[model samples]
Target: MQRFLIALCCLLCSLPAAAWNGAGHRLVAVIAWQQLSAPTRAFVSAALADHPDHSRWVERAGGHGAAAIFAEAATWADSIRNDPRYYDAGRGEPTPPIGGRFDSRRQRHWHYVDLDATGRPVKGELDRQVERLSRLLGTADAPDEITYALPWLAHLVADLHQPLHVGRSDDDGGTRFTVENPFSKRLPFLSLHAYWDELPGPSSLRGRRLQREAARLLSEHRPPAQGDVDLWREESRHLHASAYPHQAGSLLPIVDEAFQRQARATAERRLSEAGYRLGRLLEARLRHRVSRETP
Candidate 1:
């Protein structure tokens, strides 16, 4: 019995390292739902009650870590390339498939696809994916399956909002450049790709600390208009153009008050936008479905 207990402990300890780092995003989702207009919250609550297991996906996806859930869902969503917007315009190519090995190269390409194209195609794909997910939610036989898939959908929507995640084919959307940590003084740890994903703000501040800061920022900025999508696209374009490895040297010099303030502001605004958009999508789906289901 003692040996068995030790084995279980070892297994549990190993699980966290491989998990996807999605807590920040998940927090955004939860908070976003909570902050919704009462009717919107009611719609989500009804949908979840109708499919109790779907609600649990939020916790499960966060548990297995971010990468695992993302890979699994991306794979599923990639299987059906129904969204026309993801297709390459001139070449007529489908977006590169999702859910295989994490090719930093291909992932970078996906980022560009999101940035350059209209959100319509991506939104269309999400709509279909959510339909499939909602169907799966209606049936309770596969709780674990639903757990992996529902959160996967949630995470991917958030990914679409990350400007870097919408990067183009060049520079693998910033993955090609290796740079040192200006603040840590450690060996260069991340590519521009990673810096966008993880290093936008303070590492020490996490969970509620991060969520509260993000919420505050969102409140201050007000909700974005559709035109803001273009603004986001242009911002990514400029960041991509400004790439110079030595510029990383300047990262730490400004890491004090100025950097922290700027980073927090940017992260907060972007993340809040992501949450708000996600809420709108969820609310729309729930309203449509509930109307259909009613007699």
Candidate 2:
């Protein structure tokens, strides 16, 4: 069992430095889907169908239905990290993808907002981008623009719920610090950010298993109250300090059974809240659009 735990830890450590692994993002989408009204779901389906990568998402889901496609699309923002089609801004000039309202540059800074110990923004556009994208999705008249904004908005909302993303820049949102896990003797230390990112479970989780887990999360955790991005960011920021494992006078914090247990619970709660909050946001945005168009 120890060897297996070590292997799992090593595998999780190797995952990309996204807020949550693919499974977590997808699970959030699935849980959100459960809360969405039928009209909101239909709006989502229509908007996604027009996405440039819609076909690719369908293919990846093995031609699954709308729910699977929606779950797949939740990871699209992170998916572009390795995609050559989109280059990081200021890094290089690649011929932009030839399509409607598409900015081919990967907006890496859109993922998180790093605040200083005093709560001043040092970098990252996550808060600003979420508000902008949410507004754009709600008010945009162009189909293509809606397509372009939907995935980004969905993704950023989930990212905003991750405590580290809204946390301090002191340790680069916990990525700079390494925590030792006693469960793994061979590979005892891993980045604190990576440890939190993997708490939602494996990156390959999908399909029925994903749905079941999401359902279980919903059952176990109550939905968060309706709040704007600012409120959400504040909540995450407050939780950030507590995310670090505490050890008296020790530079390195050790992740023992108790710490892991609490961390896992916190991570799961965040995931659940992310899903419910996203659902409410989408429903409001889409329903407003419907009301405007009904005239």
Best by TM-score: 2
TM-score of each: 0.52, 0.89
For 9-75, candidate 1 gives per-residue lDDT tens digits of 4333321111113444644465355445556454444433333233343344445433223222332
Residue 129 error, candidate 1, Å: 8.1
lDDT of 2 at 119: 84
**Per-residue C-alpha lDDT of model 2 across residues 1-295, encoded as one tens digit per residue:** 6645754565456543577888888888888888887777887888888788898889877655788899889899999898988888678877577354577877889988999988888989999999998898778888788888878877888888888888588877777767776665545667777777777888899777887899999999987897898998998899876788876213357787878898889889988998998888888887877555433
Give lDDT: candidate 2, residue 37. 76
TM match of model 2 to true structure: 0.89
Model 2 accuracy (lDDT, Cα): 0.81
What lDDT score belongs to each candidate, Candidate 1 first? Answer: 0.43, 0.81
User: What lDDT is reached at residue 155 by model 2?
Assistant: 83
